[model samples]
Structures are given as C-alpha cells and as structure tokens.
Target: MDGLIDRVETERKLRNVWHWLPDAVSEFPIETWAELNVTVADSNAPYRPVTRFESLLQKTTTVRYLRPEVALMEPCFDVLYRQVHDGVDVTLIDRPNCHTYFLSTYPERSSELLQQDNFTVLEHDELPPYGTGLLDERVTISCYEQESGTVQAVIDTDAPPVRGWAQSVYENYLSDARPIESRL
Candidate 1:
C-alpha cells in the first residue's frame, strides 16, 4: 500500500514575515493612527499568509518588498525583487508584483534570540509606539509559529490605510487573533 510520494501526507507548519528590518530598534511606530494588535490562527485556514499579503499589496501603493521565509520561498512565486541578507538570498515582490514574506524564526523566542543574534521581536506590544517610524502606513506583517505551532501576526499593522482592516483580517485570516501579545 506504499508508493512513490503516494503516502501523500500533507504536513503543515506555521510561517511568519516581519514588516521591519533585522536591526529595527522597535515595532511599527503607532503615531496618530488608531490601534495596534497581534493575531493567530490554525494551519488549515482558508487563506494562506502569502495570499493575504498579496491582497494588502494590491490595496496599497508603497509596499514594494516581501522577504518570505526559507520554507515558503519555492511556493512564493513570481516575485519582482530579490535581496541577500546574511548570506541568504531572499525574494520579495514589489510594486506591480507586490507580495508577502516570512521569517524562519519564532516570535515567541525572539526576545531570547536577540541577545545571541542581531534579531528583533516582531511582537505587537513591545514595538515602541513612539520610536522609529518603521512603517509609513498600516501594513499587516504576518508569520507562523517557529515549529508550525500557530499562525502568528495577522493584524500586524502600523496604521491602516483604510478603516476596518482588522475586522477584515479577522473575517478572512484569523482564528483566535489574540490582541497585543508578543508572538515575535
């Protein structure tokens, strides 16, 4: 009863992508905007993180890059731009080809890793609301748990270009969507 790839066991792992740089001092600066929050979901959600990211890109005008996780690089097809970070070549979608990206790290243990490496937590709360303006407008940066545990960062936004983005995300992407918790 065994065959070549016929076992066909489709295993799922959560993934994530940050909207900030590796050395970013803080999270997306929440200025005159409304609110900020973090969200989570199951691995079998109807929409993939990349699909959500692509939707965001299509709605916005400035989003021009996406640095996806190592695991999803092959699935993240037809990106417009590519960049090399720490000896790892990453792909990003920009402008007309805008897309999403994920990091190959865990948001929960990000704080601990920061001291060991030049990493920053992508949590929704710790991100200084008054520090650097990492995001020009509200953008949803998303990812999955380190070990495919849960879907992290769904409502990851700085300032929503339009109202109801959170609501929209909840409806389309989130399952539990715990607010103001540090997943990264």
Candidate 2:
C-alpha cells in the first residue's frame, strides 16, 4: 500500500511539472523589439545589425568592428566617424583586400578616416568572411550572402555567454592583425 501511494505521489508531481512547461507551439512573440535588437535584410533574411550598433554608440565609450568586406563599411562610416570625432575609441579590423578597396573607392575619405586620433584600423590576412561589432557591453553579428553581396542578418545580444564568445573571437583576430598605418 505504501508503494502504491509513493507511485501516485510521483505521478502527481510529474503532472504538476508538466503543466508548468511552456507550450512549444504557442504563437506568442518570443521577444519584443527592444529586447531583440535584430535586423534582417536581403531576400533570404540576413542579419544587419548596423542600426542597433549606431543606437548603442550614443552610450558607448569604446567600439570594435570586425569586417571582412569593404562594402560593409560604407553604411556605418558616418556614424563611426562621428563617434570617433566625439572622442569615442574605435577599432576596425578587416582584410588587406578591404583596405585596398577602401582606398580605391574613397581615396579622399580614406585619408580623413585614417587620420582620426581616436580611430584605429587594422588588417589581418586570416580574418573570417563575416562582420561583428562590439559596442559597449553588447555584441552584434552580421552575416552576408556570398552571391548577392548583401547583408543576410544581424543578431544583437547582451547575453553574457554570447558576449563572451564574441569577445573571444574578436580578440583572436585583433591579435593577428597589423595596423593599417603600419602597412601604409
């Protein structure tokens, strides 16, 4: 009789726990616009977190950008330039190919951009073919479409684990990169 009572009690506890679980198929929004600082572009919905970074820049004292392509730099250049002008520390990492493209495409602007006291740009041969930005305590990741040459998606998160992982990746690349001025 004791065994039967124990089994019944266990089953009752299991049922209680099951009732507390969230519905997997529910249509409720998982995150609000403020919580999920994500932006999707392109036909396939790629991440483009530039707007989030721009907004975060207002409150950030330091900014780090890891970019693989020159084209990706154009959109955020104005915001970054303004931040650097306003005394925010900014670091940019990209490939040598991107440097060459920047110089060719914006010969005049490159001089002004590189001459800023608060700005530092580095080139790394082994930079992965994607973009990531660190603004203050938040991290934003941008993926691109190889064929369309457009941003696919940008994911922004302040989650501790995700920020830690992104910081690790940024540090690895930053260590391997050489200052663009040194190369010039």
Each model's TM-score?
A: 0.31, 0.70
> Clashes per prediction?
12, 7
RMSD of 2: 12.2
Cα error of candidate 1 at position 30, Å: 10
Question: 76-95 in candidate 1: lDDT tens per residue?
Answer: 33231211112212212211
Q: Best candidate per lDDT, number?
A: 2
Model 2: per-residue Cα lDDT at residue 167 = 84
Candidate 1: misplaced stretches above 4 Å? 1-34, 37-39, 43-48, 64-67, 70-136, 148-151, 160-184
Query: Any idea what lDDT model 2 has?
Result: 0.64
Candidate 2 residues lying further than 4 Å off, grouped into runs, are 1-36, 42-50, 57-59
lDDT of each: 0.31, 0.64
